[model samples]
Target: MSARSIALDHLGGAEAAASLVSGQLDDLLIDTDLPRPGTIYRAIADRPVKGQGGMFVRTPDGPAFLRQVKGLAPGQPILVQVTGYAEPGKALPVTARLLFKSRYAIVTPEAPGLNLSRGIKDEDLRDSLLEIAHDALGGQEIGLILRSACADADPDAVAEDIRAMHDLARAVLADAAGQGPEKLVEGDGPHTLAWRDWVEPADVACRPGSFATLGVLDQVEALRRAEVALPGGGSCYIEPTRALVAVDVNTGGDTSPAAGLKANLAMARDLPRQLRLRGLGGQITLDLAPMPKKDRRAFETALRAAFRADPVETALAGWSPLGHFELQRKRDRLPLTDVM
Candidate 1:
């Protein structure tokens, strides 16, 4: 993965734009202008008030509700991440689980354990990266989640990113203490965080009509076309309900001997991408084309491998008795459809 050129084009409407770029053999339709999942913000802590699940603080953006967490006081300034969008006339929910985002890796204050390489498959290299992050942070309570881009990055580069995030967290805290109520210390709005220090100057570019013309339009099309055609001759229909997201696959006209197998494999690869691109999260049920019992194990293995590449944490619960694939992905923000 070389340094790819990124151009931001604002379509027309407020903050309407998309990032057009070819990466890893795929054309990623990223909404660069919108506040995405995992973005950090600086907010003033209002008087803590009891809420359904936790304490709530009113910020300039909106009301940010949290659980009964500590280390907070009324009139105190703090940083938060947009966990989910609030319903109309409802309070927006936020989390203190700070994350430092970069193209190469994401640094979080939460440490699940000593396994710094929680998702990486290579045991030896995992241990090595873990040691690097540990040493770079100097025992700071933080963890690193290397992005797919790190697969080709140098060890030194990874270490540098981890250290940078640690420094960034300190800077954010210092900046928050002096910030006025509802004033943005970083980023374009109180909902977003600025990464001007970490972002390479040469990598940034501006273009008009990128968001409005491309991102918003693409989002409208994706929601309208709930059913998407697969690579070969199959199709997958996405149904979003209040309870969970359900996807059903059909092997259109491909009646070959391995039609079911092929469709299932294609779906395994495409579904994760679709979920990320569309910002779909929480429980998901995939109804794949039926295959022979003997081949079921292989199908599951392929599905797991495909999902392993997702940036978010996903759990595959294997196949259900109804022959559907059950899974869950962590929800960090509103779905793309809702954001648009």
Candidate 2:
């Protein structure tokens, strides 16, 4: 068959992986409820590219795929692909093809109540179903990705699909419903990328190249607006927090008398904008580091004066003996991810 860029939406767990491979399924997509640090594609792709949901592996040989995942909780029945190629594009990694063939893609009443309704209860039901599928159905011990729209899916549509799937499942279940363990259970879906609009952050940049470089510049700008500057001439340390963030300043190489209070004040005054652009929230602390007593007092006075320019409930208490200035701001949401 000619290669096409097929994208599999809710391709559940390990068993699903096996089935797809057995059938020589095209591109796959996976989802995760929690942040994934590492993934399996690295262990299996023709060329794996990490994305938000999971890693994607593609080759001219076949299709790119995504996987679905839930946050790993304690004791959850884990569905790992039992057998597969150690390398990319291998046929049916595990399980027997004859067993999978006629019955490979059947669907059954997987967690009926869960599939039937809305709200948190449905979620619980779905999870329970996944457990049953794994423990009872020779299911490849995989889980499902429940979509938000499922809560609102039309009952008729859901029923129709479920019935069609259940029929197929009955056929498969006949020979091995409770027979020797199988590798997977086909999942439910009229899957599409429609909900991406709601979950993705509009402000966070996910460009192809160096967005990190832009992030660094943005951080420097925030500080500049706060009028924070180096003493001799170095850089600042900024720690982002969910509630607020802290910035530490170190004078680099300037050491000139003119670079004293004027520079420090400049850095302190300009930093807030950078905070906003970076979507930094929470309390902020500034440690100016040690300086000549005279320069310290001047820098402090200049900092207090700058706060008045765009005063927004931001308060800069004069430096502590440790040369730290503290700022507290109320936070309504989480902070940005990039570190400056």
Top candidate on lDDT is 1
Kindly report which residue stretches of model 1 are placed more than 4 angstroms away from their true locations once superposed: 1-7, 12-53, 68-79, 84-91, 103-168, 175-223
Q: How well does each candidate superpose onto the true structure, as a TM-score?
A: 0.65, 0.30
Q: What is the lDDT of residue 267 in candidate 2?
A: 66
Q: How many backbone clashes are present in model 2?
A: 52
Measured on C-alpha atoms, candidate 1 has an lDDT of 0.62
**Candidate 1 structure quality by residue, lDDT tens digits, 1-340:** 3353334443233343232334221222333443444446676767665554356665666567766567677767777776654544656666777666665557666653333334467777766776776787798665667654454468898878777776876776666666644533233321122232123222334556433433435544665568888889898898778778899988999998788888888888878777765667789999888677777888888888888866567899777888888998876435656654
RMSD of 2: 18.6
Report residue 199 deviation for candidate 1 (angstroms): 11
Highest-scoring model, TM-score: 1
* Candidate 2 accuracy as TM-score: 0.30
> Which lDDT value does model 1 have at 51?
53
lDDT of 2 at 243: 45
